[model samples]
Target: MELQLALDLVNIPEGIALVKEVAPFIDIVEIGTPIVINEGLHAVKAMKEAFPHLKVLADLKIMDAGGYEVMKASEAGADIVTVLGASNDLTIKGCVDEAKKQGSKVLVDMINVKDIATRAKELDALGVDYICVHTGYDGQAAGQNPFEDLATIKSVVKNSKTAIAGGIKLETLPEAIKANPDLIIVGGGITGQDDKAGVASKIRDLITQG
Candidate 1:
Protein backbone atom coordinates (compact mmCIF):
# COMPACT_ATOMS: atom_id res chain seq x y z
CA MET A 1 0.00 0.00 0.00
CA GLU A 2 1.41 3.40 -0.97
CA LEU A 3 0.75 6.26 1.42
CA GLN A 4 -0.64 9.36 -0.26
CA LEU A 5 -0.37 12.39 2.01
CA ALA A 6 -2.89 15.08 1.16
CA LEU A 7 -2.69 18.78 1.92
CA ASP A 8 -6.24 20.04 2.18
CA LEU A 9 -7.50 23.60 2.42
CA VAL A 10 -4.21 25.17 3.48
CA ASN A 11 -2.45 28.20 2.01
CA ILE A 12 0.32 27.58 -0.48
CA PRO A 13 3.22 28.43 1.82
CA GLU A 14 1.89 26.38 4.71
CA GLY A 15 1.28 23.41 2.43
CA ILE A 16 4.78 23.70 1.01
CA ALA A 17 6.22 23.88 4.52
CA LEU A 18 4.48 20.63 5.46
CA VAL A 19 5.65 19.01 2.21
CA LYS A 20 9.23 20.03 2.94
CA GLU A 21 8.98 18.42 6.34
CA VAL A 22 7.08 15.21 5.53
CA ALA A 23 7.36 14.44 1.81
CA PRO A 24 10.50 12.30 2.07
CA PHE A 25 8.56 9.47 3.73
CA ILE A 26 5.44 9.59 1.58
CA ASP A 27 5.05 7.93 -1.81
CA ILE A 28 2.65 10.50 -3.23
CA VAL A 29 1.64 14.03 -2.21
CA GLU A 30 -1.81 15.26 -3.17
CA ILE A 31 -3.03 18.82 -3.57
CA GLY A 32 -6.60 18.15 -2.35
CA THR A 33 -9.79 19.16 -4.11
CA PRO A 34 -10.51 22.04 -1.74
CA ILE A 35 -6.96 23.34 -2.17
CA VAL A 36 -7.14 23.01 -5.93
CA ILE A 37 -10.54 24.69 -6.08
CA ASN A 38 -9.19 27.53 -3.97
CA GLU A 39 -5.77 27.99 -5.53
CA GLY A 40 -6.22 26.42 -8.99
CA LEU A 41 -3.28 25.29 -11.17
CA HIS A 42 -1.08 27.92 -9.55
CA ALA A 43 -1.26 25.88 -6.36
CA VAL A 44 -0.19 22.72 -8.18
CA LYS A 45 2.61 24.69 -9.86
CA ALA A 46 3.73 26.14 -6.56
CA MET A 47 3.79 22.73 -4.88
CA LYS A 48 5.72 21.31 -7.82
CA GLU A 49 8.17 24.20 -7.64
CA ALA A 50 8.62 23.71 -3.90
CA PHE A 51 9.05 19.94 -4.04
CA PRO A 52 10.64 19.34 -7.37
CA HIS A 53 11.72 15.86 -6.37
CA LEU A 54 8.38 14.66 -5.04
CA LYS A 55 5.47 13.16 -6.98
CA VAL A 56 2.59 15.66 -7.24
CA LEU A 57 -1.14 14.90 -7.73
CA ALA A 58 -3.60 17.67 -8.43
CA ASP A 59 -7.02 16.57 -7.08
CA LEU A 60 -8.95 18.88 -9.35
CA LYS A 61 -12.11 16.67 -9.18
CA ILE A 62 -12.79 17.59 -12.79
CA MET A 63 -16.54 17.15 -13.27
CA ASP A 64 -16.62 19.10 -16.53
CA ALA A 65 -14.21 20.29 -19.18
CA GLY A 66 -12.08 17.36 -18.16
CA GLY A 67 -9.58 17.70 -20.99
CA TYR A 68 -8.93 21.40 -20.39
CA GLU A 69 -8.53 20.81 -16.67
CA VAL A 70 -6.17 17.92 -17.28
CA MET A 71 -4.10 20.04 -19.64
CA LYS A 72 -3.91 22.84 -17.13
CA ALA A 73 -2.89 20.52 -14.33
CA SER A 74 -0.28 18.84 -16.50
CA GLU A 75 1.20 22.15 -17.69
CA ALA A 76 1.38 23.18 -14.05
CA GLY A 77 3.65 20.15 -13.45
CA ALA A 78 1.24 17.72 -11.81
CA ASP A 79 2.49 14.16 -12.11
CA ILE A 80 -1.16 13.04 -11.81
CA VAL A 81 -4.52 14.73 -12.27
CA THR A 82 -8.13 13.61 -11.57
CA VAL A 83 -11.40 13.49 -13.49
CA LEU A 84 -14.80 12.51 -12.14
CA GLY A 85 -15.88 8.96 -13.02
CA ALA A 86 -19.39 10.25 -13.58
CA SER A 87 -18.17 12.33 -16.51
CA ASN A 88 -18.95 11.21 -20.05
CA ASP A 89 -16.54 8.62 -21.47
CA LEU A 90 -15.30 11.15 -24.02
CA THR A 91 -14.30 13.53 -21.26
CA ILE A 92 -12.50 10.86 -19.30
CA LYS A 93 -10.85 9.62 -22.49
CA GLY A 94 -9.78 13.13 -23.37
CA CYS A 95 -8.18 13.69 -19.99
CA VAL A 96 -6.49 10.29 -20.11
CA ASP A 97 -5.09 10.97 -23.56
CA GLU A 98 -3.90 14.43 -22.59
CA ALA A 99 -2.25 13.05 -19.47
CA LYS A 100 -0.46 10.42 -21.53
CA LYS A 101 0.73 13.09 -23.95
CA GLN A 102 2.08 15.18 -21.06
CA GLY A 103 3.66 12.11 -19.45
CA SER A 104 1.37 12.40 -16.43
CA LYS A 105 -1.03 9.91 -14.84
CA VAL A 106 -4.79 10.19 -14.57
CA LEU A 107 -6.88 9.34 -11.51
CA VAL A 108 -10.63 8.85 -12.04
CA ASP A 109 -12.53 9.96 -8.94
CA MET A 110 -15.62 7.82 -8.33
CA ILE A 111 -16.90 10.18 -5.67
CA ASN A 112 -20.58 10.37 -6.62
CA VAL A 113 -20.77 7.95 -9.51
CA LYS A 114 -23.91 5.83 -9.13
CA ASP A 115 -22.52 2.81 -10.94
CA ILE A 116 -19.01 2.80 -9.58
CA ALA A 117 -18.22 -0.70 -10.76
CA THR A 118 -19.19 0.00 -14.34
CA ARG A 119 -17.49 3.38 -14.37
CA ALA A 120 -14.35 1.92 -12.83
CA LYS A 121 -14.17 -0.78 -15.49
CA GLU A 122 -14.74 1.82 -18.17
CA LEU A 123 -11.94 3.97 -16.82
CA ASP A 124 -9.69 0.95 -16.65
CA ALA A 125 -10.44 0.29 -20.31
CA LEU A 126 -9.73 3.95 -21.04
CA GLY A 127 -6.30 3.56 -19.46
CA VAL A 128 -6.48 5.71 -16.33
CA ASP A 129 -3.62 5.32 -13.90
CA TYR A 130 -5.88 4.90 -10.87
CA ILE A 131 -9.49 4.74 -9.75
CA CYS A 132 -10.00 6.75 -6.58
CA VAL A 133 -12.70 5.38 -4.25
CA HIS A 134 -13.33 8.67 -2.56
CA THR A 135 -15.95 9.59 0.01
CA GLY A 136 -16.54 13.30 -0.13
CA TYR A 137 -15.81 15.44 2.94
CA ASP A 138 -19.50 15.91 3.57
CA GLY A 139 -20.06 12.19 3.04
CA GLN A 140 -17.48 11.35 5.69
CA ALA A 141 -18.97 13.87 8.14
CA ALA A 142 -22.22 11.97 7.70
CA GLY A 143 -20.52 8.67 8.73
CA GLN A 144 -19.62 7.14 5.38
CA ASN A 145 -16.80 4.60 5.64
CA PRO A 146 -14.11 4.27 2.99
CA PHE A 147 -12.90 0.83 4.04
CA GLU A 148 -16.04 -0.96 2.95
CA ASP A 149 -16.36 1.24 -0.08
CA LEU A 150 -12.76 0.64 -1.06
CA ALA A 151 -13.08 -3.09 -0.69
CA THR A 152 -16.04 -3.10 -3.00
CA ILE A 153 -14.33 -0.85 -5.52
CA LYS A 154 -11.15 -2.92 -5.38
CA SER A 155 -13.07 -6.05 -6.25
CA VAL A 156 -14.51 -4.30 -9.30
CA VAL A 157 -11.42 -2.71 -10.81
CA LYS A 158 -9.70 -5.18 -13.11
CA ASN A 159 -6.48 -3.43 -14.15
CA SER A 160 -6.58 0.12 -12.74
CA LYS A 161 -4.86 0.97 -9.47
CA THR A 162 -7.13 1.76 -6.51
CA ALA A 163 -6.86 4.68 -4.07
CA ILE A 164 -9.07 5.07 -0.99
CA ALA A 165 -9.74 8.46 0.56
CA GLY A 166 -11.90 9.42 3.52
CA GLY A 167 -11.57 9.75 7.29
CA ILE A 168 -8.59 7.43 7.55
CA LYS A 169 -7.38 7.15 11.12
CA LEU A 170 -4.67 4.76 12.34
CA GLU A 171 -7.17 2.21 13.61
CA THR A 172 -8.99 1.96 10.29
CA LEU A 173 -5.80 1.96 8.23
CA PRO A 174 -5.20 -1.74 8.72
CA GLU A 175 -8.66 -2.41 7.33
CA ALA A 176 -7.81 -0.27 4.33
CA ILE A 177 -4.67 -2.30 3.81
CA LYS A 178 -6.51 -5.58 4.31
CA ALA A 179 -8.32 -4.62 1.16
CA ASN A 180 -4.91 -4.59 -0.55
CA PRO A 181 -5.42 -1.41 -2.45
CA ASP A 182 -2.65 0.02 -4.63
CA LEU A 183 -2.72 3.31 -2.70
CA ILE A 184 -4.35 4.93 0.35
CA ILE A 185 -5.06 8.67 0.58
CA VAL A 186 -5.70 10.73 3.71
CA GLY A 187 -6.22 14.46 4.20
CA GLY A 188 -7.68 16.22 7.27
CA GLY A 189 -6.53 13.52 9.71
CA ILE A 190 -2.90 14.33 9.02
CA THR A 191 -3.02 17.92 7.79
CA GLY A 192 -5.25 18.90 10.71
CA GLN A 193 -2.64 17.66 13.15
CA ASP A 194 0.32 19.82 14.21
CA ASP A 195 3.00 17.20 13.58
CA LYS A 196 3.09 16.52 9.87
CA ALA A 197 6.28 14.47 9.79
CA GLY A 198 5.05 12.32 12.64
CA VAL A 199 1.77 11.72 10.89
CA ALA A 200 3.56 10.97 7.65
CA SER A 201 5.85 8.49 9.40
CA LYS A 202 2.95 6.78 11.13
CA ILE A 203 1.18 6.39 7.80
CA ARG A 204 4.35 5.02 6.18
CA ASP A 205 4.77 2.50 8.99
CA LEU A 206 1.18 1.36 8.54
CA ILE A 207 1.71 0.93 4.83
CA THR A 208 4.86 -1.06 5.52
CA GLN A 209 3.13 -3.24 8.06
CA GLY A 210 0.14 -3.71 5.81
Candidate 2:
Protein backbone atom coordinates (compact mmCIF):
# COMPACT_ATOMS: atom_id res chain seq x y z
CA MET A 1 0.00 0.00 0.00
CA GLU A 2 1.12 3.56 -0.75
CA LEU A 3 0.21 6.66 1.25
CA GLN A 4 -0.97 9.79 -0.58
CA LEU A 5 -1.34 13.12 1.18
CA ALA A 6 -4.21 15.20 -0.20
CA LEU A 7 -3.68 18.96 -0.05
CA ASP A 8 -7.21 20.24 -0.45
CA LEU A 9 -7.40 23.09 2.02
CA VAL A 10 -4.01 24.63 1.50
CA ASN A 11 -2.57 27.14 -0.92
CA ILE A 12 0.61 26.31 -2.83
CA PRO A 13 2.98 27.55 -0.13
CA GLU A 14 1.10 25.87 2.70
CA GLY A 15 0.85 22.70 0.67
CA ILE A 16 4.58 22.78 0.10
CA ALA A 17 5.31 23.24 3.80
CA LEU A 18 2.98 20.37 4.72
CA VAL A 19 4.51 18.01 2.20
CA LYS A 20 8.04 18.95 3.21
CA GLU A 21 7.15 17.86 6.74
CA VAL A 22 5.85 14.48 5.67
CA ALA A 23 7.49 14.02 2.29
CA PRO A 24 9.52 11.00 3.30
CA PHE A 25 6.41 9.16 4.48
CA ILE A 26 4.27 9.68 1.39
CA ASP A 27 4.52 8.19 -2.10
CA ILE A 28 2.20 10.69 -3.80
CA VAL A 29 1.36 14.32 -3.10
CA GLU A 30 -2.12 15.19 -4.32
CA ILE A 31 -2.88 18.74 -5.41
CA GLY A 32 -6.57 18.35 -4.60
CA THR A 33 -9.62 19.70 -6.45
CA PRO A 34 -10.05 22.74 -4.23
CA ILE A 35 -6.37 23.57 -4.38
CA VAL A 36 -6.42 23.25 -8.12
CA ILE A 37 -9.53 25.39 -8.29
CA ASN A 38 -7.99 28.01 -6.05
CA GLU A 39 -4.39 27.95 -7.17
CA GLY A 40 -4.73 26.46 -10.64
CA LEU A 41 -2.39 23.87 -12.19
CA HIS A 42 0.35 26.14 -10.94
CA ALA A 43 -0.14 24.22 -7.70
CA VAL A 44 0.87 21.02 -9.42
CA LYS A 45 3.80 22.70 -11.07
CA ALA A 46 4.98 24.22 -7.82
CA MET A 47 4.62 21.00 -5.89
CA LYS A 48 6.52 19.06 -8.51
CA GLU A 49 9.22 21.72 -8.62
CA ALA A 50 9.52 21.69 -4.85
CA PHE A 51 9.61 17.93 -4.35
CA PRO A 52 11.03 16.50 -7.53
CA HIS A 53 11.52 13.07 -6.01
CA LEU A 54 7.88 12.49 -5.01
CA LYS A 55 5.09 11.78 -7.44
CA VAL A 56 2.50 14.57 -7.82
CA LEU A 57 -1.16 13.97 -8.63
CA ALA A 58 -3.47 16.69 -9.97
CA ASP A 59 -7.03 15.96 -8.83
CA LEU A 60 -8.86 17.47 -11.76
CA LYS A 61 -11.79 15.09 -11.14
CA ILE A 62 -12.26 15.71 -14.81
CA MET A 63 -15.76 15.26 -16.19
CA ASP A 64 -15.03 15.94 -19.88
CA ALA A 65 -12.30 16.65 -22.39
CA GLY A 66 -10.17 14.08 -20.63
CA GLY A 67 -7.45 13.99 -23.23
CA TYR A 68 -6.89 17.74 -23.25
CA GLU A 69 -7.05 18.01 -19.49
CA VAL A 70 -4.60 15.16 -18.96
CA MET A 71 -2.30 16.64 -21.54
CA LYS A 72 -2.29 20.00 -19.78
CA ALA A 73 -1.76 18.45 -16.36
CA SER A 74 1.04 16.28 -17.59
CA GLU A 75 2.66 19.32 -19.12
CA ALA A 76 2.33 20.98 -15.76
CA GLY A 77 4.31 18.08 -14.26
CA ALA A 78 1.55 15.86 -12.90
CA ASP A 79 2.48 12.21 -12.62
CA ILE A 80 -1.20 11.24 -12.47
CA VAL A 81 -4.50 12.99 -13.28
CA THR A 82 -8.06 12.11 -12.27
CA VAL A 83 -11.32 11.81 -14.20
CA LEU A 84 -14.75 11.13 -12.76
CA GLY A 85 -16.01 7.55 -13.06
CA ALA A 86 -19.47 8.79 -14.04
CA SER A 87 -18.07 10.43 -17.20
CA ASN A 88 -18.73 8.90 -20.63
CA ASP A 89 -16.67 5.84 -21.55
CA LEU A 90 -15.06 7.72 -24.41
CA THR A 91 -14.01 10.47 -22.03
CA ILE A 92 -12.39 7.95 -19.71
CA LYS A 93 -10.66 6.18 -22.58
CA GLY A 94 -9.46 9.49 -23.93
CA CYS A 95 -7.87 10.21 -20.58
CA VAL A 96 -6.07 6.86 -20.53
CA ASP A 97 -4.80 7.33 -24.06
CA GLU A 98 -3.64 10.87 -23.45
CA ALA A 99 -1.96 9.95 -20.19
CA LYS A 100 0.11 7.36 -22.00
CA LYS A 101 1.29 9.87 -24.56
CA GLN A 102 2.20 12.32 -21.81
CA GLY A 103 4.01 9.63 -19.82
CA SER A 104 1.52 10.16 -17.01
CA LYS A 105 -1.28 8.04 -15.49
CA VAL A 106 -5.03 8.43 -15.01
CA LEU A 107 -7.13 7.69 -11.94
CA VAL A 108 -10.91 7.31 -12.32
CA ASP A 109 -12.64 8.67 -9.22
CA MET A 110 -15.77 6.72 -8.28
CA ILE A 111 -17.20 9.32 -5.95
CA ASN A 112 -20.97 9.21 -6.50
CA VAL A 113 -21.09 6.43 -9.06
CA LYS A 114 -24.16 4.42 -7.99
CA ASP A 115 -23.02 1.03 -9.26
CA ILE A 116 -19.39 0.87 -8.20
CA ALA A 117 -18.61 -2.78 -8.90
CA THR A 118 -20.06 -2.77 -12.40
CA ARG A 119 -18.51 0.59 -13.21
CA ALA A 120 -15.15 -0.42 -11.78
CA LYS A 121 -15.04 -3.45 -14.04
CA GLU A 122 -15.83 -1.30 -17.06
CA LEU A 123 -13.23 1.35 -16.13
CA ASP A 124 -10.58 -1.35 -15.63
CA ALA A 125 -11.32 -2.50 -19.15
CA LEU A 126 -10.98 1.13 -20.27
CA GLY A 127 -7.36 0.99 -19.12
CA VAL A 128 -7.36 3.60 -16.37
CA ASP A 129 -4.28 3.35 -14.20
CA TYR A 130 -6.21 3.55 -10.94
CA ILE A 131 -9.89 3.22 -9.97
CA CYS A 132 -10.44 5.17 -6.77
CA VAL A 133 -13.34 4.76 -4.36
CA HIS A 134 -13.93 8.14 -2.80
CA THR A 135 -16.34 9.82 -0.37
CA GLY A 136 -16.66 13.55 -0.82
CA TYR A 137 -16.82 16.01 2.04
CA ASP A 138 -20.62 15.95 2.05
CA GLY A 139 -20.64 12.15 2.22
CA GLN A 140 -18.14 12.21 5.04
CA ALA A 141 -20.37 14.72 6.86
CA ALA A 142 -23.16 12.16 6.54
CA GLY A 143 -20.88 9.49 8.00
CA GLN A 144 -20.28 7.74 4.69
CA ASN A 145 -16.90 6.19 3.90
CA PRO A 146 -15.14 4.30 1.08
CA PHE A 147 -14.16 1.10 2.89
CA GLU A 148 -17.09 -1.01 1.63
CA ASP A 149 -16.86 0.65 -1.77
CA LEU A 150 -13.14 -0.11 -1.85
CA ALA A 151 -13.85 -3.77 -1.24
CA THR A 152 -16.48 -3.81 -3.96
CA ILE A 153 -14.03 -2.42 -6.51
CA LYS A 154 -11.23 -4.71 -5.34
CA SER A 155 -13.44 -7.72 -5.90
CA VAL A 156 -14.39 -6.71 -9.46
CA VAL A 157 -11.60 -4.58 -10.93
CA LYS A 158 -9.13 -6.75 -12.87
CA ASN A 159 -6.78 -4.39 -14.68
CA SER A 160 -6.72 -1.10 -12.75
CA LYS A 161 -5.05 -0.60 -9.39
CA THR A 162 -7.46 0.38 -6.54
CA ALA A 163 -7.42 3.38 -4.19
CA ILE A 164 -9.57 4.90 -1.44
CA ALA A 165 -9.91 8.47 -0.18
CA GLY A 166 -11.79 10.70 2.25
CA GLY A 167 -11.30 11.54 5.89
CA ILE A 168 -8.88 8.69 6.56
CA LYS A 169 -7.05 9.23 9.86
CA LEU A 170 -4.80 7.23 12.15
CA GLU A 171 -7.75 6.16 14.30
CA THR A 172 -9.59 4.53 11.38
CA LEU A 173 -6.62 3.69 9.18
CA PRO A 174 -6.35 0.06 10.25
CA GLU A 175 -9.92 -0.40 9.07
CA ALA A 176 -8.92 0.85 5.63
CA ILE A 177 -5.73 -1.21 5.70
CA LYS A 178 -7.66 -4.47 6.06
CA ALA A 179 -9.33 -3.78 2.70
CA ASN A 180 -5.84 -3.46 1.16
CA PRO A 181 -6.22 -0.60 -1.29
CA ASP A 182 -3.20 0.00 -3.52
CA LEU A 183 -3.24 3.70 -2.59
CA ILE A 184 -4.65 5.22 0.60
CA ILE A 185 -5.42 8.97 0.28
CA VAL A 186 -5.65 11.05 3.44
CA GLY A 187 -6.54 14.74 3.62
CA GLY A 188 -7.47 16.35 6.94
CA GLY A 189 -6.48 13.09 8.59
CA ILE A 190 -2.92 14.29 8.76
CA THR A 191 -3.18 17.90 7.61
CA GLY A 192 -5.59 18.82 10.40
CA GLN A 193 -3.41 17.38 13.10
CA ASP A 194 -1.11 19.41 15.34
CA ASP A 195 1.81 17.04 14.81
CA LYS A 196 1.63 16.53 11.07
CA ALA A 197 4.93 14.75 10.60
CA GLY A 198 4.40 12.52 13.62
CA VAL A 199 0.94 11.54 12.43
CA ALA A 200 2.16 10.97 8.90
CA SER A 201 5.06 8.86 10.11
CA LYS A 202 2.74 6.61 12.07
CA ILE A 203 0.41 6.26 9.11
CA ARG A 204 3.41 5.31 6.98
CA ASP A 205 4.45 2.69 9.52
CA LEU A 206 0.96 1.15 9.48
CA ILE A 207 0.95 0.92 5.68
CA THR A 208 4.42 -0.63 5.76
CA GLN A 209 3.28 -3.24 8.28
CA GLY A 210 0.32 -4.19 6.12
Candidate 3:
Protein backbone atom coordinates (compact mmCIF):
# COMPACT_ATOMS: atom_id res chain seq x y z
CA MET A 1 0.00 0.00 0.00
CA GLU A 2 1.06 3.63 -0.63
CA LEU A 3 0.15 6.97 0.87
CA GLN A 4 -1.01 9.83 -1.35
CA LEU A 5 -1.51 13.25 0.22
CA ALA A 6 -4.22 15.29 -1.51
CA LEU A 7 -3.74 19.05 -1.64
CA ASP A 8 -7.23 20.32 -2.23
CA LEU A 9 -7.72 23.58 -0.29
CA VAL A 10 -4.25 25.03 -0.51
CA ASN A 11 -2.62 27.22 -3.15
CA ILE A 12 0.70 26.52 -4.88
CA PRO A 13 3.05 27.80 -2.14
CA GLU A 14 0.98 26.39 0.71
CA GLY A 15 0.65 23.08 -1.03
CA ILE A 16 4.39 22.93 -1.63
CA ALA A 17 5.13 23.65 2.01
CA LEU A 18 2.70 21.00 3.22
CA VAL A 19 4.14 18.37 0.89
CA LYS A 20 7.68 19.22 1.99
CA GLU A 21 6.64 18.46 5.56
CA VAL A 22 5.31 14.99 4.73
CA ALA A 23 7.34 14.22 1.62
CA PRO A 24 9.27 11.41 3.26
CA PHE A 25 6.10 9.55 4.27
CA ILE A 26 4.03 9.98 1.08
CA ASP A 27 4.54 8.07 -2.15
CA ILE A 28 2.39 10.43 -4.23
CA VAL A 29 1.48 14.10 -3.98
CA GLU A 30 -1.87 14.94 -5.50
CA ILE A 31 -2.49 18.37 -6.99
CA GLY A 32 -6.25 18.20 -6.43
CA THR A 33 -9.04 19.32 -8.75
CA PRO A 34 -9.76 22.54 -6.89
CA ILE A 35 -6.11 23.58 -6.86
CA VAL A 36 -5.71 22.60 -10.50
CA ILE A 37 -8.75 24.68 -11.34
CA ASN A 38 -7.41 27.63 -9.35
CA GLU A 39 -3.67 27.46 -10.10
CA GLY A 40 -3.67 25.49 -13.34
CA LEU A 41 -1.20 22.75 -14.28
CA HIS A 42 1.54 25.14 -13.22
CA ALA A 43 0.78 23.76 -9.75
CA VAL A 44 1.58 20.28 -11.00
CA LYS A 45 4.79 21.52 -12.62
CA ALA A 46 5.83 23.39 -9.50
CA MET A 47 5.09 20.45 -7.19
CA LYS A 48 7.06 18.07 -9.38
CA GLU A 49 9.94 20.53 -9.64
CA ALA A 50 9.99 20.99 -5.87
CA PHE A 51 9.74 17.32 -4.95
CA PRO A 52 11.34 15.41 -7.76
CA HIS A 53 11.47 12.17 -5.79
CA LEU A 54 7.72 11.93 -5.20
CA LYS A 55 5.14 10.96 -7.82
CA VAL A 56 2.87 13.92 -8.64
CA LEU A 57 -0.79 13.29 -9.59
CA ALA A 58 -2.77 15.96 -11.40
CA ASP A 59 -6.45 15.52 -10.44
CA LEU A 60 -7.87 16.70 -13.68
CA LYS A 61 -11.06 14.64 -13.01
CA ILE A 62 -11.23 14.99 -16.75
CA MET A 63 -14.67 14.52 -18.31
CA ASP A 64 -13.83 15.35 -21.95
CA ALA A 65 -10.91 15.73 -24.37
CA GLY A 66 -9.28 13.12 -22.19
CA GLY A 67 -6.22 12.56 -24.35
CA TYR A 68 -5.43 16.22 -24.84
CA GLU A 69 -5.87 17.16 -21.17
CA VAL A 70 -3.79 14.21 -20.02
CA MET A 71 -1.12 15.02 -22.60
CA LYS A 72 -0.95 18.59 -21.31
CA ALA A 73 -0.70 17.37 -17.73
CA SER A 74 2.06 14.96 -18.71
CA GLU A 75 3.95 17.77 -20.42
CA ALA A 76 3.60 19.74 -17.23
CA GLY A 77 5.46 16.94 -15.37
CA ALA A 78 2.55 15.02 -13.88
CA ASP A 79 3.29 11.34 -13.36
CA ILE A 80 -0.40 10.40 -13.15
CA VAL A 81 -3.66 12.05 -14.23
CA THR A 82 -7.28 11.36 -13.19
CA VAL A 83 -10.31 10.90 -15.45
CA LEU A 84 -13.89 10.50 -14.34
CA GLY A 85 -15.24 6.93 -14.30
CA ALA A 86 -18.59 8.14 -15.61
CA SER A 87 -16.99 9.29 -18.88
CA ASN A 88 -17.65 7.32 -22.04
CA ASP A 89 -15.44 4.31 -22.72
CA LEU A 90 -13.83 6.08 -25.67
CA THR A 91 -12.79 8.97 -23.42
CA ILE A 92 -11.30 6.58 -20.89
CA LYS A 93 -9.50 4.79 -23.73
CA GLY A 94 -8.18 8.08 -24.99
CA CYS A 95 -6.67 8.81 -21.57
CA VAL A 96 -5.01 5.39 -21.32
CA ASP A 97 -3.58 5.65 -24.84
CA GLU A 98 -2.18 9.14 -24.28
CA ALA A 99 -0.85 8.28 -20.86
CA LYS A 100 1.03 5.35 -22.34
CA LYS A 101 2.48 7.51 -25.08
CA GLN A 102 3.57 10.13 -22.51
CA GLY A 103 5.08 7.52 -20.17
CA SER A 104 2.52 8.46 -17.51
CA LYS A 105 -0.36 6.63 -15.83
CA VAL A 106 -4.14 7.07 -15.71
CA LEU A 107 -6.44 6.71 -12.66
CA VAL A 108 -10.17 6.60 -13.34
CA ASP A 109 -12.10 8.31 -10.53
CA MET A 110 -15.39 6.57 -9.66
CA ILE A 111 -16.80 9.52 -7.77
CA ASN A 112 -20.46 9.41 -8.68
CA VAL A 113 -20.81 6.29 -10.78
CA LYS A 114 -24.15 4.61 -9.93
CA ASP A 115 -22.96 1.11 -10.70
CA ILE A 116 -19.40 0.96 -9.42
CA ALA A 117 -19.00 -2.81 -9.76
CA THR A 118 -20.07 -2.84 -13.39
CA ARG A 119 -18.01 0.25 -14.26
CA ALA A 120 -14.92 -0.95 -12.43
CA LYS A 121 -14.91 -4.26 -14.26
CA GLU A 122 -15.20 -2.51 -17.61
CA LEU A 123 -12.47 0.00 -16.73
CA ASP A 124 -10.15 -2.81 -15.67
CA ALA A 125 -10.61 -4.31 -19.16
CA LEU A 126 -9.84 -0.87 -20.59
CA GLY A 127 -6.32 -1.05 -19.08
CA VAL A 128 -6.42 1.92 -16.74
CA ASP A 129 -3.53 2.00 -14.28
CA TYR A 130 -5.76 2.49 -11.23
CA ILE A 131 -9.49 2.46 -10.51
CA CYS A 132 -10.28 4.84 -7.65
CA VAL A 133 -13.47 4.84 -5.56
CA HIS A 134 -14.02 8.38 -4.41
CA THR A 135 -16.73 9.97 -2.24
CA GLY A 136 -17.04 13.56 -3.35
CA TYR A 137 -17.30 16.47 -0.87
CA ASP A 138 -21.06 16.56 -1.15
CA GLY A 139 -21.29 12.85 -0.52
CA GLN A 140 -18.98 13.21 2.48
CA ALA A 141 -21.30 15.86 3.89
CA ALA A 142 -24.12 13.39 3.53
CA GLY A 143 -22.05 10.83 5.53
CA GLN A 144 -21.06 8.76 2.52
CA ASN A 145 -17.67 7.03 2.27
CA PRO A 146 -15.70 5.03 -0.25
CA PHE A 147 -15.02 1.99 1.93
CA GLU A 148 -17.96 -0.11 0.68
CA ASP A 149 -17.40 1.13 -2.84
CA LEU A 150 -13.73 0.25 -2.50
CA ALA A 151 -14.71 -3.30 -1.63
CA THR A 152 -17.04 -3.39 -4.62
CA ILE A 153 -14.20 -2.57 -6.98
CA LYS A 154 -11.65 -4.77 -5.25
CA SER A 155 -13.76 -7.84 -5.76
CA VAL A 156 -14.45 -7.16 -9.45
CA VAL A 157 -11.35 -5.39 -10.78
CA LYS A 158 -8.80 -7.84 -12.07
CA ASN A 159 -6.26 -5.81 -14.02
CA SER A 160 -6.14 -2.34 -12.49
CA LYS A 161 -4.83 -1.38 -9.08
CA THR A 162 -7.32 0.11 -6.60
CA ALA A 163 -7.45 3.42 -4.69
CA ILE A 164 -9.83 4.98 -2.13
CA ALA A 165 -10.35 8.60 -1.21
CA GLY A 166 -12.47 11.11 0.70
CA GLY A 167 -12.80 11.76 4.46
CA ILE A 168 -10.06 9.33 5.45
CA LYS A 169 -8.62 10.24 8.86
CA LEU A 170 -6.24 8.59 11.31
CA GLU A 171 -9.07 7.12 13.36
CA THR A 172 -10.67 5.63 10.25
CA LEU A 173 -7.51 4.71 8.36
CA PRO A 174 -7.07 1.29 9.91
CA GLU A 175 -10.47 0.28 8.53
CA ALA A 176 -9.48 1.58 5.14
CA ILE A 177 -6.20 -0.31 5.39
CA LYS A 178 -7.99 -3.57 6.11
CA ALA A 179 -9.51 -3.28 2.62
CA ASN A 180 -5.94 -3.20 1.25
CA PRO A 181 -6.20 -0.52 -1.40
CA ASP A 182 -3.12 0.07 -3.53
CA LEU A 183 -3.27 3.76 -2.69
CA ILE A 184 -4.93 5.61 0.23
CA ILE A 185 -5.75 9.27 -0.41
CA VAL A 186 -6.12 11.78 2.47
CA GLY A 187 -6.80 15.49 2.10
CA GLY A 188 -8.16 17.44 5.09
CA GLY A 189 -7.49 14.41 7.26
CA ILE A 190 -3.88 15.54 7.33
CA THR A 191 -3.96 19.18 6.26
CA GLY A 192 -6.76 20.22 8.60
CA GLN A 193 -4.91 19.01 11.67
CA ASP A 194 -2.96 21.27 13.99
CA ASP A 195 0.09 19.03 13.78
CA LYS A 196 0.22 18.24 10.10
CA ALA A 197 3.58 16.50 9.90
CA GLY A 198 2.99 14.44 13.02
CA VAL A 199 -0.41 13.34 11.75
CA ALA A 200 1.07 12.41 8.39
CA SER A 201 3.89 10.48 10.05
CA LYS A 202 1.44 8.45 12.12
CA ILE A 203 -0.68 7.73 9.09
CA ARG A 204 2.42 6.57 7.24
CA ASP A 205 3.32 4.32 10.13
CA LEU A 206 -0.15 2.78 10.08
CA ILE A 207 0.10 2.11 6.35
CA THR A 208 3.53 0.58 6.87
CA GLN A 209 2.32 -1.65 9.71
CA GLY A 210 -0.53 -2.92 7.59
Best by lDDT: 3
Quick one: ranking by lDDT, best first? 3, 2, 1
lDDT of 3 by residue, 39-97 (tens): 99999999999999999999999999999999999999999999999999999999999
Candidate 3 local Cα displacement, residue 104, angstroms: 0.5
**Candidate 3 pairs with clashing backbones:** none
Provide backbone clash counts, one per model. 0, 0, 0
Candidate 1 local distance difference test against the native = 0.83
lDDT of 3: 0.95
In order, the Cα lDDT scores of the candidates are: 0.83, 0.94, 0.95
Query: Model 2: clashing residue pairs?
Result: none
lDDT of 2 by residue, 1-210 (tens): 999999998899999989999999999999999999998999999999999999999999999998999999999999999999999999998999999999999999999999998999999999999999999999999999888899889999788899999889999999999999999999999999999999999999999999
The count of residue-pair clashes in candidate 3 stands at 0
Model 1 lDDT tens row, 30-53: 998788878878889998888888
